[model samples]
Target: MTTTIEILNPTFARVSGQELRKAPFPRLEEGTKVRIGFLNNQKPNTQELLALVESGLREHYQVESRTFFKGDAAHPAPPEVIEELSRFADVAVLATAD
Candidate 1:
């Protein structure tokens, strides 16, 4: 008697490495004020969580500015909001609080 087996994976889609684009990661230098941007998904406790993160960073680094943008919870951020954030923030932190 012969037996056959089937294998399966949980992933629904596979993305090619060539299709991915890499963004530059900016390095923070000591003694220089860093601009921080917060993108909030407007979920519960997102604002509070971002605030806590901001406070933690401030305790260790010199922050230049804190820019906050609220985006829709179910959709991607608007282009205008992204543009504004890019203009003001050197680095961005996106929050999806539960």
Candidate 2:
């Protein structure tokens, strides 16, 4: 009797090596009004941590910000949410809490 063994990959994969299709958005310009968006991954204490960081940032620079919390951390932020942030924010800070 002969037996054969089969191997399987029981794992997920990540996307990579994509080329940019468009130019990146410009950085915050010098001496210009700045609007920053803070995104929280809804992990424990992330909001508190971001708030502290925001406070520290404000101490050094005059800027505005809006805070957003993702519905779930395991998945990426919704496309609409990202679009809205792009329209409203000049820069974004994504927070991931371990």
Candidate 3:
């Protein structure tokens, strides 16, 4: 009696050259408005940090920020709160004080 063994080769899909190229940075012009969102994670001194950030933004750029949304001490911000923040601001900053 005789025995035989078989081997299989692995196959891979090829990627396009365009897909491997890095994306260009977005162009920014002067006087463009910027929106900033601040979230208070119910930590101590949260207000102070927010104040500092607000002042810095005002001095540096055309910026606007909404009041800190207070989250529960034991729980994170609800979906509604997150949705509200996303709608109101372009970017958000969540803070916690030690």
Candidate 4:
């Protein structure tokens, strides 16, 4: 006997990646300290990866980080998580280790 399982995924109409080019990077004053929010995409080792990236950023920039959010395996960062991150961080690094 054999068994089969099905998985469903959300779909969106395809869009050109070029559309992203119009967005600009956020501006910060020289020497402005940056708070980085680290998001885990609910994957194994995500926290460790985020920590390493945070460490690297700290070595060169005025940086701090908080692991303030997590998401299920199939979803990206949640809106609430993003909102919270925006409140505390100038930039964010999302990590996934599947």
> Of the candidates shown, which would achieve the greatest TM-score relative to the real structure?
1
Over 36-76, each residue of candidate 4 has an lDDT whose tens digit, in order, gives: 88777757777777788888877767877788766586866
Candidates in order have lDDT scores of 0.76, 0.78, 0.71, 0.73
* Residue-level lDDT tens digits of model 2 in 5-83: 9877578576687876974565654545678799889888888888898787676556798988678998888888888
True-structure lDDT of candidate 4: 0.73
TM-score ranking, best first: 1, 2, 4, 3
What lDDT score goes with residue 50 in model 1? 81
Given candidate 1, what's the lDDT at residue 91?
84
Full candidate order by lDDT, most accurate first: 2, 1, 4, 3
lDDT of 3 by residue, 1-98 (tens): 89988766456556565557664433434445668778887667777778898887677667778865756655777888888887987667854546
Between prediction 3 and prediction 4, which has the larger lDDT?
4
Q: Of 1 and 2, which scores higher on TM-score?
A: 1
Off by over 4 Å in 3: 1-31
TM-score result, candidate 1: 0.71
Candidate 3's clash total is 0
Question: Worst lDDT window (10 residues) for model 4?
Answer: 17-26
How well does candidate 1 score on lDDT at residue 14?
A: 75
lDDT of 1 by residue, 16-58 (tens): 6576678776777765688888888878788888888888888
How many clashes does each candidate structure show, in the order listed? 0, 0, 0, 0
